[model samples]
Target: MERNFLRRLITAPVAVALVLGLAACGGSASDPGTPGANALSGSDQESTDKYTTEKVIPLEEVDPAQLDLITEGTLRVGTLSDAPPNIFIDETGKFTGFDNELLRAIGKKLDLEVEFASTDFSSLLAQVQNKQFDVGSSSISTTDSRRENIGFTNGYDFGYMAVVTKTDAEIKGFDDIGDGKRIGVVQGTVQDDYATNTLGIEPVRFYDYNTVYSNVRNGQIDAWVAPSQQAEGQVKKGDETVIAESVINTQNFTAYAVNSGNKELLDALNSGLDAVVEDGTWNELVKEWYPEREVPKDWAPGSQAVKLP
Candidate 1:
């Protein structure tokens, strides 16, 4: 009878422990229905929080007089709607790229909200000049002709004009692209000017980069000329095209453009650019967008020569 009583005590405790263990496992604090639970891992949460934070710049510390904002506290920016690596709308409907991120950083420093206006590349400068936009943030190259109508900030990037052709095209280099061959270029761009004025070729014009790529892929055009980075991006997508050679080897730097009369706004943009460069924000953006390309250490807007790393 004593032995039986001891066995009962041991078995009862064992059964009770197993029941509690199963109950605890069924309703853990880390489970899906737990209150205040997070589904994302720790690293994902950090990354999400980094980009989703609304308030990056301390507004209270910024001087309102310096901003000279167009709409009280908003910076009106004009950019291309489809140019990738510079400014473009993604599949997820998010505005992102090197230029977009840089503008966002500039807005943060000035304690202003950025309102982006999408338009064609050809119209960016004219819109800025007409005061339709406070600034143009497209990958607008700084040239003497543009300076006559718009004030350019210090150049933030240098780009080369490249020629791209089909992988099996007989064109091996710029020299092989004869005058009789049909070439495609974005209208009102340096490439267009080169084809018409410099190369003495009557080139076909397209408004958007995708159209140019499609035309070349479908044999609608023999070759296309655009910025080296833009051409490289298309090539990197595993398309049936390749960057044949750089036609314009000169240093063409790109910068933000403002109305010629808006000195105050220009000064504010320069100040913001200085802040981003000094605080490593510019480097972070460059690393993110142009991971394979090198940004010069002493590079500032309008700096003449940029050697890629």
Candidate 2:
């Protein structure tokens, strides 16, 4: 996985262009009528207050034997290899990013080993529910619909939604998104749900960030609705793409996904998360990875027992 991601990062320019060209020729945009394409609605969302306010179980009370982990003392995590700064593979082929590193810290608190595997964002949640991985560390937003299938730890991060477009394009901001524009989004993402349900438009769904952002740069798509941190990472100098607009949605806090049946693992993670937050590891990682974006005063990670420094 590390070698594959390294190769992809090294050959991104050539590979992205080829992928965009092929996608354009084959009409890869998802049909709105298709199941899971534009299927999300307001009903999918639920208040996260329960997760935010729930008292974390004491760390000592967490029994690893009851956690039903894939491995006895290791957390086999599922994450993306493309979305940067939060959950991507670095140039050295190391899975060291904000989300993964934060999870590592939590594992340390729990006296567990943290291991990561790269997978598509589309299948990550389902894979976690199926116990393919002990946790999903892809900056997943916890929603009511998603909760039906899998469980989530208390939030460790917040995020912003962004729209990326060519510098010369007419789409300047979020409001500029309307009918008759070719908008791209990662499949099975909150951005996909927003573009489909809120904007009332059919979106071109790509499996990974590289492909969607590639289409934006190549003019094959007018805009890409993406996570702000990832958009900033991808839209580098002279890339011909810019993050035209970004809006913070504090309602949906980003958390680690776990299997629904694993209550012990969920409670254990929440305890570990509170530990990190209380010790200031969470704040440090936020400052390190998200230097450009400030943490909103109204928001903080972990349970109410822990506060950001």
Candidate 3:
């Protein structure tokens, strides 16, 4: 028997398929049909009341010019192991990636300790609303629907979604996917809605974000709709291929979300993000995680901020 000593990730949501023993955050408790109540209604959320993530960090490494607040301890972050580049256990059994590095710098700057709480991707927003953690550093995109449930900071990074499949699959779009076609996605995600409604396709929802890619690679699932950045990582790890590039919906912004009503926290996040970008730490992290892609010359924190009509 292989000895498995994987620890659960605390910052993001896990897929339903990722076994509890192997999952970073356990699975979400949300009912797909019922959106979670305001954070006040959840029990585990009590940790967030005085919940703070504080640490001392070297801005020079991530951003030297930013206003630094040296806090007392680690910031408890929630996550689901549903996506990579943002969160994942590399083959080396270490939790390291885009979200991890960026959050580390943020914690260092704020002087907060960093702890990750792993859960199901489907349960992330509800957990955030419930105050399950201080922040969600996952690469979550901002959708008006989600904004209605929780507040999102300005986009820290952006990437579109795509459909990955076998090189030989005959899929053009939703019409090509069928009941017999086992599509993979994290339950309660935008990809879930897209596959179920937009594309008019039904998918096999997995527990761990990795299982989708795993099933697809093994020919157990026909395709997977995933974020572009993470898709590449899964492909490289599992030897999969991208069959199509899905475009972003017109109204969404890639962003980090916080519990609603936390204006002070939101302000801090925006301020920290601006400082990161101005001092070039944002660009550096982008280069480190996604060397193949490029940030728009005009892209900056809050540059994408828009007033709802």
Number of the top candidate by lDDT?
2
State residue 122's C-alpha deviation in candidate 1, in Å. Answer: 1.0
Q: Give the candidate number with the greatest TM-score.
A: 2
TM-scores, one per candidate: 0.74, 0.83, 0.70
Q: Evaluate candidate 1 by giving its C-alpha RMSD to the native, one decimal.
A: 25.3
Each model's lDDT: 0.61, 0.73, 0.55
**Cα misplacement distance, residue 179 of candidate 2 (Å):** 1.7
> What lDDT tens digits, residue by residue, belong to model 2 across residues 35-143?
2232222221222365565579888988777778899999999999988888899899999789999999999999899999999888888888889999999878666
Clashes of 3: 46
**TM-score order of candidates, top first:** 2, 1, 3
Worst 10 residues of 1 by lDDT: 17-26
**RMSD of candidates 1 onward, in order:** 25.3, 10.1, 13.1
**lDDT of each residue in 21-87, candidate 1, tens digit only:** 1100001112233322221112111111111112123334457556556777888888776778888
Is candidate 2 or 3 superior in TM-score?
2
